[model samples]
Target: MTRNKLRLAIIGAGPAGIYAADILLKSERHFDVSIDLFDHLPAPYGLVRYGVAPDHPRIKGIITALREVLDRGDIRIFGNVRFGEDLTLDDLKRHYNAVIFATGAVRDASLNIPGIDLEGSYGAADFVSWYDGHPDYPREWPLEAQSVAVIGNGNVALDVSRILAKHPEDLLPTEIPANVYEGLQRSPVTDVHVFGRRGPTSVKFTPLELRELGELRDVDMIVHDEDFDYDDAARAAVAGNKQVLVIDKVLQQWRQREVGSASRRLHLHFFAKPVEVVGDEHGQVAAFRWERTAPDGEGGVVGTGEIREIPVQALYRAVGYYGSPLPGIPFDKRLGVIPNHEGQVLIRDKESGKSRQMYGVYCTGWIKRGPVGLIGHTKSDAMETIKHVINDLGNWWRPESPSEESVVELLESRGIRWTDLDGWHRLDEHEQALGAAEERARIKVVPRDEMVSISRGEV
Candidate 1:
């Protein structure tokens, strides 16, 4: 007697989706499973490739582990195949035993403040995508600003601040694309103001990231002495959390340093909550107006009615990322995640008039849980989702057409140009060869058409 094989389809080839495939394949449940990872782009490793800052090669190193998983050959990668346009939820249900959506958030979460729509005001997500050489974003970025303001205190805010203040030549050692390098070279930015709504102890930045700000060459890290005012709650947080302690220590050291004669400066402002983005006559960002905040004794802050204004040529909001709704998934617009309970998707029951699980469909990563944690957090999240999947394995709907070849046949019938694992290898070699000529790690292909062409072996 032959054992039955399970067919799984995972959308979005990012860390979350890939990690799920890895866990499912490595499980000791004694069931044979085949996973087909699908991605809209012509490459895998979604955020690791597109969202991470080019200068942080250490963070990008996570790709090495992800690459090993893909190279295992047990899992199949279908690149350049979109979830909605190329294939639908119905199509997935027809061919796979179960579906997992790991499409992580790519857009910036809105900051609903006045003047946020000003011409010079932009989302940090767009800037990050441009600098990371994402294929979908435009090649050129408006970098003529002399001074900029970055709202938020997370790693992304740091990335935006560092990219704005650092000398363009310093980024050459990394795998920054030609377009991004050129854009950075043209930047006239001299000062970067980073604002946090809470005190220093409540900042979201990790210690290593905070320390790196002070280490940038020719950029003075300036932390105002007044910003160090922490209440009892803030002090308690610093004592309770090791990361907060490290961040506080790093900021204190920066505060004690005498202002160095650097061409560029990065100013850290705590307890400053942006109330409005002031615009000039032409409707371009001219300055930022923020209200002072004080600890509310609950690890949060309250406005103190004291406002201050800082002149800036541009503003970038890096508050957070939000996921978009898939074609047939139940999405919580407010939370920016799929409506789920323990990884099982929830939908409104027509008869019962209550929320219930949508059998056989699941979600993981930022799409399941709101985008909050780092890449390391994705592993544990995936484990939780996978456990739910395993528990529902017995009840998964049986498909009329479950063979792996059925998916290929469907794509062919739809005339969709999909690339396989071999295509990714070809594109990978092409990029590495380009990098070899330049004496760098790898130069990313910046254009979508070019990437598709290279992946298809046309280039």
Candidate 2:
């Protein structure tokens, strides 16, 4: 007998997966839909809760909308549920009719260069994780460098630069926990240099983030005169795009401002492509070397062979975020995304190079399309996946036990102490209360077990 309802399991509880559930509910499908969201962490939001910097409250505001969706009492959420470990493909096969993987990328995209693995060198993603109170990363960070080099021009590069250069006192207003504030307070950092491979107009930075970089308290912004030689292509970009124009206006304003006498200084270097990370005798970061690049008149740059080396103890590579392959999913290692056509996962036969859909398996967000746009792009991404779910309803799994009660019973049998929506409420209130005592918005809980305990109302 055909079932009257659809049991859907979304592997991530972040914006991507939540958005997919929301779209499914609003879809004009004939069958009833039941969604269950699962996250590996005790919390729901993936990167929004862990990968985002502490000072970016505006970006974090997307949580309000996501929270509304989860709180609607229609969709169920299970926290601390690892897909491959706690719940396997066999488990999902029995419980749900279809599954969507929205596991967004967290690993840093590799930056291939000599001596890139020095002790003082780090990935910007790990730094963001540390400041955001991600429980998995170590609580301590080494902020011993007086001069630091940040290689990249995106928002993440700016974030790492701002956090390293800003006085620790300025970070007190954010939601960063006590440990992060204390770690930053001990920092001896004075000058932070940011390098970009392309010219100013060709930067990947958004106008808002670029402007915010100029507003850091007591920090002098420096843009070299040599880097301002914009080509015709650069000028065309500034004139054609409104966002590019605003960014150019800000950079030009900085160009005009007289260098002020501030204790900390942030230098923005454009048309500089990093070539090597020089290591000292002790195998620690000693300096950074890069080649000056010039526009090739084709919207790209060619190395000018003018190598420059800067003495710096620490370097952060903020190239990009790459996805992790799921245990049972067909992943394209080169692209760091599940092998998919549209949203339907396409698995290839190794011997024949043939392609076919893994029935009912779908992907969305960064895992689906690689890390590209912001939350707005994620909404449209989910639309693509859920559209397939509605159209390919005939291809969904026929579970042996599709009842919600059977799923609950299986979880209880496994000794999995998973968290539900009510548990999240408890943890949320606890964090808010902690922040209230300190006269701040919220103080994030940093321990996995502690978060689970609070969510379970054990303490």
Candidate 3:
């Protein structure tokens, strides 16, 4: 009387999905369990490929460790397969004993501002996707502007600001597609502004990322004195940190240099909320109308009667990423998460008790939780979800008929060539080769056409 091995399909090849697979594959009790991981991109490593800034090769190296887990005999990698688009939730439930939706949030939260729909206004996701060489984005980008306004204070904003500040020779090393790389080299934009509604303490950027702003030998980092007026708690966040102290020292240096410089500038502005985006006659953003804000004593911004006008030709709303509705899963639109207790997927009617009607349907990462936390934080969140999944394995192993389809078979039948560990190795080599050709670290293939051709057989 041996227990049945669980059949699992983890949709999403991001950090959460990869970590979940890693843990499950390593667990002795789950030796018999099999996993088929799916991702929309031809290449694996979701955010690692698309979200992280191109220049940060060290952060992208996490893929090497993930590649180890993927090499395990029981785990399969299915790239270039979209979950909801190619296969339905019900379709997945019909095949595997359990399905884990680790699909990371894909879309950005829209700013519903008056002129946000203008041609020059873009979301941070698009901005990132463009520069990072996401296959879906076009190779040509709009870089012929003088000033750009990015509305967020997160690491992403920092990344965008850093790239904008990079000298062309420095940028030549990363895998930016030829056209984007050329466009950036010819970029007319010299000033970048990252705006936040709150003070520096409430900013989503970690201290490490903030310090990178000072690394630019050619770019000036400017912080208005007015923006640093934090209240007690907010002040405490910066008082004792070595990184914060470094940031303070860097800003002090930047202040001394801000008076007159011809170099590109990365300006961090706080306590200002965009009330409206002013657009030119051609429907491109020309400037921004912002209202002054002060701390309301309870970790929020309160509007002041003061107003400020800043000239801008480009804008990106990097407020945050949001989750989209998945079929058959209960979604909480307000919270941007699927309804669940701990890590257990909760049914609308069965909220009072744990229900296992659907055998292997589960969720992890941003889709299960919400788009929050850094990559390291995803490990703990994934572990909690795996615990619930392992506990619920009993119900899926009953004496009834077994699932007929698994993610691997469906992908194979559809002619989707998912890269195994060896295949990814080849891609890694190819990317490095391309990088060498450009005399840069690694040049990314940004166009979807090129990514598809390379993944398929054209390259």
Candidate 4:
């Protein structure tokens, strides 16, 4: 084995990408190693930058740590560059010794139902993106709505509803985009309902997120007593689990207060499955036709035929995120991922049962293993995959025959424009300036064009 460092290209700048870069940059074998970090957004920190709720300052602090990693002299960051769109897999394989795909699952799972195409129906991802001021989403909170129904009971559903029910004064201090804050200040909605097809015991919200709902001053919280008819054993099973218990406690606390005087309402409805989304004359969601459901005694749910309709103008679906196919990667439609053995991108010969290795191509994050784990899980995953890549570096990088693919040349030839590390500094300055002008925490540009133009010196 030669005493040479490996040249690596990491495809995403989120937790997995940043953590992997951190591991490589901090390694003892620094002599021949270099890294190029690529991201579609001008800014990095994948989910922490766009996916996380704006009010969550604690989680957003991870961005600062990631910035330090990018500051390392051995690393190069290419922002506003997408793999499929700008850089191809073939291109990536040639440019770097090994490429790590950390492009996260950004799409939301669809709820296939009639009238889902209605104007008011929105994916939780889109709603979060809009309010979080993700540069891609046009600046606006569609809260002129009178009522909203969020389908699915997860932390994200809670996040969407909480932001809706929260008073503008309570949210203003947070880093929400100015336009979102303004639209929310005039929200017409009086009630926001969070729904679940299952009972409270199966709800996926964390205790920290559940408790935050209690601090909302403008909205009244409610959980129907009928939602919890679980046997004594089931109740005892969840008694110590803080997340489930927090929901129980919050429901109890809200029940004690007189509810009518509250300006807005946040209702938690369980055992309800949406049968159909009812639309108005103008093709907007007017109401949701929900059927009561209960456990079918075999870990399944059965509807009780009892139906109820609730008026609503907007809906957010937070079921889950699903992966999409990337160019030049073997995609498994059923699994919503590129088939992999550990972190190596697995490609199988169609005629034979044998698996072929796609050399210099690796994957991490939700796309590698199904999108299930939290942010911290990515670190261990990236490390494991990175070990494998680092081990195989000898096959690619060599002193005499070092690969000749230059990222700068490739980008220039394709007319795929991007900003180098210095360009990101300018974008950073612009965002900080916007935040300063607003007298709030870091303000963000939520439009893709704005970010691209700013990096291109058009702004």
The TM-score that candidate 1 achieves is 0.97
* Candidate 1 weakest ten by summed lDDT: 1-10
Model 1 segments beyond 4 Å from truth? 1-3, 350-352
Clashes of each: 0, 0, 7, 4
lDDT at 251, model 3:
56
The reply for model 4, stretches above 4 Å from the true place, is: 1-3, 27-31, 240-242, 296-300, 394-405, 453-459
> TM-scores for all candidates?
0.97, 0.99, 0.90, 0.91
Put down candidate 4 lDDT per residue, 54-137, tens digits, no spaces. 888998888888788777656788888888889876666555567888887878888888888899898998888888877777
The segments of candidate 3 whose C-alpha lies over 4 angstroms from its true place after superposition are 28-31, 229-231, 240-246, 297-299, 350-359, 397-409, 447-453, 456-459
Q: Write the per-residue lDDT of candidate 1 for residues 52-136, one digit (tens) a residue.
A: 8998999988999999999999999898899999999888888888899999999999999999999999999999999999988
Instruction: Please provide, for model 3 over 1-459, each residue's C-alpha lDDT reduced to its tens digit, 9 standing for 90 to 100.
Output: 126677777888888899998887666574377677878787788888888887787898998787777766566776777777677766665666777778888788878778988888888888788887787877777886789898887887788878777776676667666776787888887888888888666777776787777777677777788766668766665686666655555555656664446478888888888888999898889998888899887778899979898999988888888888777787878878876765567666566665444445678899877888877778988888888778876755332323434445766777765555455656666777888876866766655555656665567
RMSD of each: 1.6, 0.9, 3.0, 2.8
- In model 4, how many backbone clashes occur? 4
lDDT of each: 0.90, 0.92, 0.75, 0.79
For candidate 4, report its TM-score: 0.91
lDDT by residue for model 2 (35-83), tens = 9999999998889988777889999998999999999999999998899
